[model samples]
Target: MKKVFGILFVAGMVAFASCTSATEATEDAAAAVDSAATAVDSAATAVVDSAATVVDSAAAAVK
Candidate 1:
C-alpha cells in the first residue's frame, strides 16, 4: 500500500508540472499576439498620418 501511494504521488507531481508548462506556453503565445496587434495598429496610424500630410500639401499647392 505504501509503495502504491508513493507511486501515485510521484505521478501526480509529474502531471501537475506538465500542466504548468503548457499554461505558461499558452500565456506567452497570447502575449506575442497582443504585441503584434499593437505593432499593426501603430503602422496603420503612421500610414494615415502620411496620407493626410500629402493631401494637405496638395491642397496648399492648389490654393
Candidate 2:
C-alpha cells in the first residue's frame, strides 16, 4: 500500500509539471506570433509610403 501511494504521488507531480510547461509554451508562441504580425504591418506601411513618394517624384519630373 505504501509503494502504491508513493507511485501515485510521483505521478501527480509529473502531471502537474507537464500542464504548466505546456501552458507556458502556448503563451510564448502567441507572443511570438503577435510580434511578427506587428513587424509585417509596419513593413507594409513603409512600402505604401515609398510607392507614393516614387509616384510624386515621377509626376514632378514630367511637369
Candidate 3:
C-alpha cells in the first residue's frame, strides 16, 4: 500500500510539472508574437514618415 501511494504521488507531481512548463512555453510564444508585431508596426510607421518627408521636399522644390 505504501509503495502504491508513493508511485501515485510521484506521478501526480510529474503531471503538475509538465502542465506548468507547457503553460510557460505558451506564454513565451505569445510574448514573442506580440514583440514581433510591435516591431513591424514601428517599421511601417518609419517608412510612412520618410515618404511624407520626401513628398514635402519635392513640393517645396517645385514651388
Candidate 4:
C-alpha cells in the first residue's frame, strides 16, 4: 500500500512539473511575440519620422 501511494505521489509530481514547464514555455512565446511587435512598431515610427524629415528638407530646398 505504501509503495503504491509513493508511486502515485511521484507520478502526480511529474505531471505537475510538466504542466509548469509548458506554461512557462507559453509565457515565453507570448513575451517574444510582444517584443517583436514592439520592434516592428518602433521601426515603423522611424520610417514615418524619416519620411517627414525628407519632406521638410525638400520644402526647404524649394523655398
Which pairs clash (backbone N, Cα, C closer than 3 Å) in model 1?
A: none
Which prediction has the highest TM-score against the true structure?
1
Candidate 2's TM-score: 0.59
Every model's TM-score: 0.63, 0.59, 0.62, 0.59
Root mean square deviation (Cα) for candidate 4? 5.4
How does each model score on lDDT?
Answer: 0.96, 0.96, 0.96, 0.95
- Minimum summed lDDT over a 10-residue window in model 4 is located at 17-26
- Give the alpha carbon lDDT tens digit for every residue of 1-63 in model 1: 999999999999999988765777889999999999999999999999999999999999999
Task: Tell me how far the alpha carbon of residue 18 in candidate 2 is from the true structure, in angstroms, after superposition.
Answer: 7.5
Clashes of each: 0, 0, 0, 0
Better of 2 and 3 by TM-score: 3
Instruction: Kindly list the per-residue Cα lDDT of model 3 for residues 26-49, writing each as its tens digit.
Output: 899999999999999999999999
lDDT for residue 51 in candidate 3, whole number 0-100: 100
lDDT per residue as tens, model 2, 1-63: 999999999999999988765777889999999999999999999999999999999999999
Weakest ten-residue segment in model 2 by summed lDDT? 17-26
Model 4 stretches astray by more than 4 angstroms: 1-21
Model 1, residue 10: C-alpha shift (Å):
18
